[model samples]
Target: MIVTHEIPAIQTVDFTANTTYGDFRDDLVRDGYAVIKGAVSKEKAAHYVDRYHDYLEGFGLGYDRNDPSTVKEELLPVINEKGMLFHYSAIHEDFVWGMRAEPGVLKVFETIYDTEDLLVSFDAINVSFPNRKDITPNVPWPHQDQDPERPGFRCVQGLLNLLPNGDDDGGLLVLPGAHNISVEFHEQFKDEEQLYRWTNETYFFTDAGMKWLDTKGFKWVKVNADPGDLIIFLVEG
Candidate 1:
C-alpha cells in the first residue's frame, strides 16, 4: 500500500493556574484534539521516564533508557501476561493510574461534561520504537475509537508525552473536525465487513472507510508534543 501522511501545524495551549475550561473544550470540539502543554512538571516527567526504564529491566528486557546500546529493536515489545503494554508492570500501573486521577486532568474532563461525575479509562501506554532494516514501517491506520451503536463524543482518549516529539516522530495522528460528523460517518459504514472498533490497544480503519473519510475532507494531522504535555481526542461513534 502506498501510504502518505500530512503533517499540519498544530496549536498547543499552556495549562496554567488561571486556564479556563472553555479553552480546553473549544479546542477539543473544534479540532477533535487538544494539546495541554506542561500538564505535568518537568521533574515528574523525568522521574517517569527513569521509572519506565526500571520497569523494563524488571520485566527481563534489561532496557536502559539512556543507552540505546542495550536495545535489540527486533527483540523489543516485551509484554507480560496481562497484555504487553507499557503500563503492564505493577510499577507503571500505579504511575499511569495516578496520572489519570490528577486534579487538573479531572477538572478538564469534569468541566467538559458539566458534571463532577466522571469515569477514567483504564488505558495502557503506547511505545513505538524506530523501525529496523528488517522491520516494516509502522504506518498510521486512521480510524475512530467507536462503534455504530454509540454516537457523538461518548468517550475521550488521552496521551501523556514522556518525551519530546518532532514532526517526523511516529505519534498520534488525527483528523480535525472529523468528530463533528462521526455519527454520519458511522452510518455510512454501518454495513462494512469490518468497521473500526475501539480496543484497549488500538483502533483501525479499512480502505473503504479511509476513502470515505477523505471524500468528506478529513486529513491526517500528526501530533507533536513535548515532555510533560498531554493530548486528548474525542472518540465519537
Candidate 2:
C-alpha cells in the first residue's frame, strides 16, 4: 500500500524580489534545495507550457486538452507508467532551452558557484494534467540524483516550474540536511553493488533510506512554486 506523508514546512527564497546569492547558498546548504520565486515571468512559463502541449499533440497520443474524445485511452497507461512523451531531448528544443539559458536562472547559478562558466543540463520536463480521472498520476518516490558515497557540494540540478505546483498538481519533496550524513549512508550500503550500479545513480529511499531520513529528522518538505519559479538544489545522495 502507498503510504501518505505529512506536509512539512518548506523554505522559499525570492530570486526575483529580494533574495541574494548568500541567502540562496545558505538555504541550499541547509535544506539541500532552494525554491527561487519568480525566476521567470508567468507569461514566459505559459509559452513553454504551450510548447509542451504542442509536443504532446504531435506525439500522436490522441490527447486533446479540450476534448476527451480525442484522448487515446489505450495510450494513457504507457504514458503514465513510462512517460514516453516526457523527452529530455526537449532540452535542445527552443522552449526548454530558453528556460535553461534564462538570464535570471543563469545569474543565480553563476552567483552560487562564483563562476560565469557553466554547463546547462539537458533535463526532461513532466506534463501532468490536473484533475485527470483518466490517467493515474506518477507519484514521486523520495530519491537523490547524486551518488551517496560522493559527499560535499558537487553539480547542482535545476527544475524550472512551467506550471504551478502544489496539492493535487504534484511537486517536489526534499529531505532537508540529508546531505550532511549521505556519506555515512553510502558507507553502510557500499557493499550493495546493484544499488549503486552507476556513479551518479539516483538513490531511491526504500525501507533502509527511509529509516535514515526518519531518524535524522529529515521530513518530506514539499516544494511549492508558481509558474516560472525555478527550483535549484545541490546534488546530494
Candidate 3:
C-alpha cells in the first residue's frame, strides 16, 4: 500500500510590516543566519518524519552523495534496504513552495539581502540524523555545492528540521561571514590538500584526493533548534 501522511496544508507565512521585516533582516546580517521558530509545527514535521521512518523500515536509508537524497518532492528518503537507493518526494508542494512565503524566512532574507522581492525554494528533506552528533559539518572541501571552475551564485539554503537538534545532536554548523569572502579563497583551499602535509607530501594529486580537503576560513556557529524550527542561510546572490 502506498502510505499517506496526515500533514495539514502549510499556511502562508506573513511579514506584512516593516517591524517584522527588519527583525529578520537584522538577524541574518548580524549572524549570517536566521531561525524560524515553530516554522513547520511539530505535529506537521512529525507526519513527514514518520513517513520517513515507515519508508525506511520497509525499504531503508542511504546517502546519495554530499548530502542524503530522498525523493526531493515528497520528502521520501532513499533507504538502504539490503543495499539499494530510493528517492521520494511525497512531501507537499505547499510545504516546499510555502517556505518562500514563510513570514519568518521572508523577513530574514529581506533584512539580510535588503530586498523585499525575495523568493525561497525548498531544496530537499535535508534529514539531519538523530542526536546532534549524527549530523555532518557544513564545511566544504571547496565550493561543494558547485563546480570548481564555474563559480555560481549560492542560493540561500533553507533547512526544515524534521527532528530535534542540538550541538550534540547534529544541527547545522555555519561559518559566519564566510559567505562574504572571495570564492578565490575556496578555490585556493581546494587545491591544497592538508593530508599531503601530514603524509610528508606523499599525497597523490587526484580529484578524489582533494575531495577530502574540507576547511573554511571563518568562525563556524552551530544553530540549535527543534523539529518545527527552520534555518535560513544567505549565500552569494
Number of the predicted model whose lDDT against the real structure is largest: 2
Q: What is the lDDT of candidate 2?
A: 0.68
Candidate 2 regions with alpha-carbon error over 4 angstroms? 1-21, 68-88, 131-137, 192-200
Q: Per-residue lDDT of 111-158 in model 3, one digit per residue for the tens?
A: 444579765443344443432222233433322333233333334566
User: Across residues 10-53, which tens digit of lDDT does each residue of candidate 2 receive?
Assistant: 23332222454566676776667888888889998998888877
Rank ordering of all candidates by TM-score, starting from the highest = 2, 1, 3
Candidate 2, residue 1: Cα displacement in angstroms equals 45
Which ten-residue region of model 1 has the weakest summed lDDT?
Answer: 8-17
lDDT of 1 by residue, 1-237 (tens): 879554432223322224444676668756878998888877787887776666666656556666666655434454432222643454347666766776667766676666788766654665555543444445555655664454544567787788889898777778888776766876787766773445422346688888888998888888899988888887652
* Steric clash pairs (candidate 1): none
Worst 10 residues of 2 by lDDT: 8-17
Candidate 3 has an lDDT of 0.49
Assess every candidate by TM-score.
0.76, 0.78, 0.50
Looking at model 3, residue 174 earns an lDDT score of 68
Candidate 3 Cα errors over 4 Å, as ranges:
1-21, 57-86, 89-123, 128-154, 183-217
- Candidate 3's TM-score: 0.50
